[model samples]
Target: MKTYIHNFIAYKELLKELVQRDIRIKYRRSFLGMLWSVLNPLGMMIIMTLVFSHVFRAGIDNFPVYLMCGQVIFNFFNEATTMAMQSILGNAPLIRKVYLPKYLFPMSKVCSCFVNLLTSCIALALVVVVTRTPLTWKLVLFVFPILYVFLFSLGIGILLSAVVVTFRDLQHLYGVIITGLTYLTPIFYPIEILPGWVKTLVEMNPLTSFVEMFRDAVLYGVVPGMELHIRCIAACVVALVLGIWSFIKQQDTFILKV
Candidate 1:
C-alpha cells in the first residue's frame, strides 16, 4: 500500500496532465464548450420542472432546486463511472508503451468529471437564487454529500476500469444499468410516491442517501441527520475499498487482456 501511495504521488504530475487532457477532449470542437456543463442541467431542470412539477404534482417547495440537486449528484456519479469504464481500453496505446500507474487513468477521469460537477453546482445555485429558496447555514453541509459521492464514484470507476478491460461487453451493459439506476434514484420524483417495496429498494441505493443529504442541505435547509452521514460515509468506504482491492488483484493480468 505504501508503494502504491508512493507511486501515485510520484506520478501526480502525469495525473494532472491526464485530467486536463480529459477536460479538453470533452469540450473539443464543441461550440458551447464547458458552458454545456452548466446549461445542460439547467435546461433539463426547466423541462422536468414543467413536466413533473405538474404531472406528478411533486408538491415540494422549490421543486426546481430539489430536482437540480438530485440531477447534479447522480449525473456526476454516472458520468464519472461511465468515463472511467473506458479509461483503460481508451488509452490502450499509451498503456502498452508506458510504465505509469494504471489507476491514474481512472482517477483522472473521476477528477475531470468532478470539475463538471462543480460547474453543475453553479447551475443549481442559480436556480436556488432564482426560485428564492432560502439559504441557510446548512448549505455548508452540502459539501459532505459531494465528497462522499466523489469517493464512491472513484471506487466504482476504478473497479469498472479494471473489469471492462477484459469484458468489453460490459461497456454496453453498464449503460443499461445506469439507465435503470436513474429511474430508481428518485431524481425528479418524490420517494413518497413510490410503493413501499420500491421505496425501500431506492432507499437502499447509495446514491439515494447522497441525494437526500444534498437536498437536506441545499434544498430543504436542514442539516443531514447522523444516520445519513454514517450511511454516506459507510457507502463511500465500502465502494472505495472494494474498487481498490479489485484493481490491485487484477492489475497484473491487465496487460495480457488489454
Candidate 2:
C-alpha cells in the first residue's frame, strides 16, 4: 500500500494526464459541458421534490432538502461505480501502448466523478439557501461519511475495473444489479417505512448506512453515531483490502488480455 502511494506520488504527472483525458472525454462535443455535471442531480432534485414531495405526499420535514442530500450522494456512488467498471478496458489502448500505472485508470475516473459530485453539492447548497433551510455546524459531520463513501467507491471501482477488463458482460449486469439495489436502498423513501424483516436484511448493505448517514447530517443536522461510523470504516476496509489484493494479484497479466 505504501509502495503504491509512493509510486502514485512519483508519477503525479501521469495521473494528471489521465484525469484530464477523462474530463475531456466526459464532456467532449457537448454544448452544456461541465454544467451537465450539476444539471443531472439538480434536475433529479426538482423531479423528486415534485413527485415525492408534492404528488405522493410523504410526510417529512423539508422533503426536498432531504431528497437532495440522498440524491446527490446516491447518484455519485451509482455513477462512479458504473463509469469505473470499464475504466481499465476503456483505456486498453493507452495501457497497452504506454507504461503508466494501470491503477490510474480507476483513480482518474473517480476524480472525474468527484468533479461532478462537487458541482452537484454546490448546487444543492444553493437550493438549501433558496428554500430557507436552516444551517447548522452539525451538518459538517457529513464530510466524514462522504469521505468514507469515496474510499468505498474507490475500492469497489478498482475491483470492478479489473473484472470488466476480463469480462465485458459484467458491465451490463452491473447496471441491473445497481438498479435493484437502489430500490432496496432508502434514497427516495424513508427507511422506517420498510418492514421489519426487510429493514434487518437491507441494513446489512453498507449503502443503507451511507444513505441514512447522508440524510441524517445534511437534512436533519444530526451526525451518525459511533456504530454507523464503525460500520462505514469496516465497509471501507473490507473493500480496500479485497479490491487492492485482487488488482495487485491479477494486474500484471492485464496487459495480455485488456
Please report the candidate that would top lDDT against the real structure. Answer: 1
Model 1 scores a TM of: 0.98
Candidate 2 lDDT tens digits, 156-184:
98899888877879988988988888787
Alpha-carbon local distance difference test for all models: 0.93, 0.82
Q: How accurate is candidate 1 locally (lDDT)?
A: 0.93
Instruction: Please state every model's RMSD to the true fold in angstroms.
Output: 0.9, 1.6
lDDT for each residue of candidate 1 in 6-67, tens digit (9 for 90 to 100): 99889999999999999999999999999999999999999999988985664576788888
Model 2 worst lDDT window (10 residues): 53-62
Q: Which pairs of residues collide in candidate 1?
A: none
RMSD (CA, angstroms), candidate 1: 0.9
Which portions of model 1 miss their true places by more than 4 Å?
none
